[model samples]
Target: MSTIRWTEDHSRRSARWHSENHSPLPRRVVVADDRMRADHACRHAADGTALLWRGDFHNARQLLQAMGRRLDRRPPRPGSTPSESFDLHRRSRAHRAGILGKVLVLLEDDYTIALRRAPDVRLACQEAYGPPQGPVIVSLRELLGVIGARQWRVKGVDVPALDARIHPHYGVFSPVRGEYVDLVAHTPLPSTIEHRSVTTTAFDLGTGTGVLAAVLARRGVERVVATDISPRALACAKENIHRLALSGRIDVKGPCLFPEGRADLIVCNPPWLPARPTGPVEQGVYDPDSTMLNGFLTQLTAHLRPGGEGWLVLSDLAEHLGLRTRRQLLAAIHEAGLRVTDRVDTKPGHPRAQNTTDPLHAARSAEITSLWRLTSATWPPRASRHDPCAGAVRSALRRGPGSC
Candidate 1:
């Protein structure tokens, strides 16, 4: 019953087009060009062809449903994981490539909202896709996401920050991870505001929901600068900050990485696991061999004001999962010319931690979230950043996985 479909208004509707920006597609496809007779079109598509119906909008949707059900009825491969993820990922990808291989949409050169009752999605689409170049004929998924975001904006996330609501997008990483927030809010400080001159400046790196920055402000930090690279995340952060009435106090920017200037304190809640993300959403969960973590540590010394703390909220799940070691983690901190002054740990109470069905149930069950107080230091400085036996982090990209 869900209106879930991929759209590509600007993309070539033909499946044969193998373009770079576009995901890899099939070699050729057949467009139906007319109202489809279910059996006839199904048979033709079965022969490695597509049924691109130029008929009623609702009918096209109905036909897609039929095709999906038909596909679902087929038996799965032997030894398949039944959502086992590891192997299912491989099969799901292959299935996607094949089915999408046959899809072809019939559209005019300039894409337009021409359906009998298509919603007024012009503004939302423009925001996500930019001004349409000669009209963008896109996939159904993109269109739906745009319209969905519009609804979210009309409504909101009910933010206690602005005490209003911070609207979020469909795919944006929502502020569901609240454990870290509690850690930041409750953690003891290593040093009081010893500022000969109290600076209102603070920087929050990878401000996912701007929740931490909001927390910092709520804790009495004056001005906070938040930075993130993802547009969706940036939007969510801005919305949250503005809703909290901290727009005047907090500035959010799209920094490729860290922001400039010395901060009273810089905070980052990096991805906990040391693994590659399988999808766009997974980027928030998996750190891809801990690249982002290393980047923050490597750059922490430069951005932090003297005597300021770089608060790193991280989970020990990687260690619990036997993926990384604590010694290596401390070593990385040491190699970055920084030292952990203090750290406060918290246990996760999420249902997932107690769920035995999850593939990583054991690790998740034992996860420990902590806020590490970091200070720039030269103590135990690496003999060389790359010396393998030097006993710490390796090269920036290579420092994840094993040696922490």
Candidate 2:
């Protein structure tokens, strides 16, 4: 809990600084009100100075928008390659967010804003920050994000596969993209493990909203265990599971990626991109160095019952962007002593996939989400170490109907 100090009313004052993204505390702070011009605010922000807003709440929002428009006037130059373009686009976005984050607001001990026209944000703040410790200072941009997340939590996202809505908690990734969920719903479940009489058991790894676990339970999996490495995600999954009345069928646990025992079926939808995330929410979108992906692959065989299968729901968008390659992915599976039995592919129907103006439109347009069925190789597998793709075989077992 870092504290930020500033002078007001000829007296020194300070408050705890809060940033979900862990941004550094401002070196300089000054009070600004309704009289502050957008250009002046931009100048202060460009100079790495923070503005403590004391004016009408709506007016502050307008000023923030004005500053954004000014920043947008000068866009980053386009790159020659898709990878370069992606890197430049990310830098531009980070720069924009940094400038806009200069606008700050203060909340009292109980999460109340003193400015006029400020809506009651106590509930939203409590949900995001837990019990309030004392007066806290946060960027106006982050505060707005918290408010928007509250609305989404209240309204919830409807999953066609589950025929229900999943309420995502603050910092938890929502299931806005339903293509992966559909693949899980439609995949054929293994009837029985080889040489053993066992009941149907499934595990959902890195379950964010528990959408896939819910889908598995609905598909008649006798017992389902959902694991996550985030406390917020675990709580969110438990709530959703309880709401769907599948609490009896599914057990939510963790701060761990994999639970204690093996399962007949293990499913994982790791983050698609192999890059570092900029914020908490992006954790679900990016996995630095493909750590989660490789972890799942390397340890997958140990957590599977004989004749059992592992379902890997992943997107080829990273490959299209040149961040990863099919050869490397196949090599990884081979080295892990796992063989790809089958794969189911689906094209994303997200608006960005069709948007021509997006910087990564080329990759998005060609993105293919797949559900890969994997199983352990026989003892003393024949594939040589140099032949990584020898055991990797991809037969299109199924193709999803249409865009989600």
RMSD in angstroms, all models? 8.8, 3.3
**203-300 in candidate 2: lDDT tens per residue?**
99999989999999999888899999999899999999999999999999998988988999999999999988888899999999999999999999
TM-score of each: 0.69, 0.94
Which prediction has the highest lDDT against the true structure? 2
Candidate 1 lDDT for residue 309? 78
- Local error of candidate 2 at 280, Å? 0.9
lDDT of 1 at 78: 34
Scanning candidate 1 in windows of ten residues, the lowest lDDT window is 395-404
lDDT of each: 0.62, 0.88
Tens digit of per-residue lDDT, candidate 1, span 33-59:
336665565566556554444455666
Q: Give per-residue lDDT, candidate 1, residue 124.
A: 72
Model 2: CA > 4 A from native:
193-197, 379-404
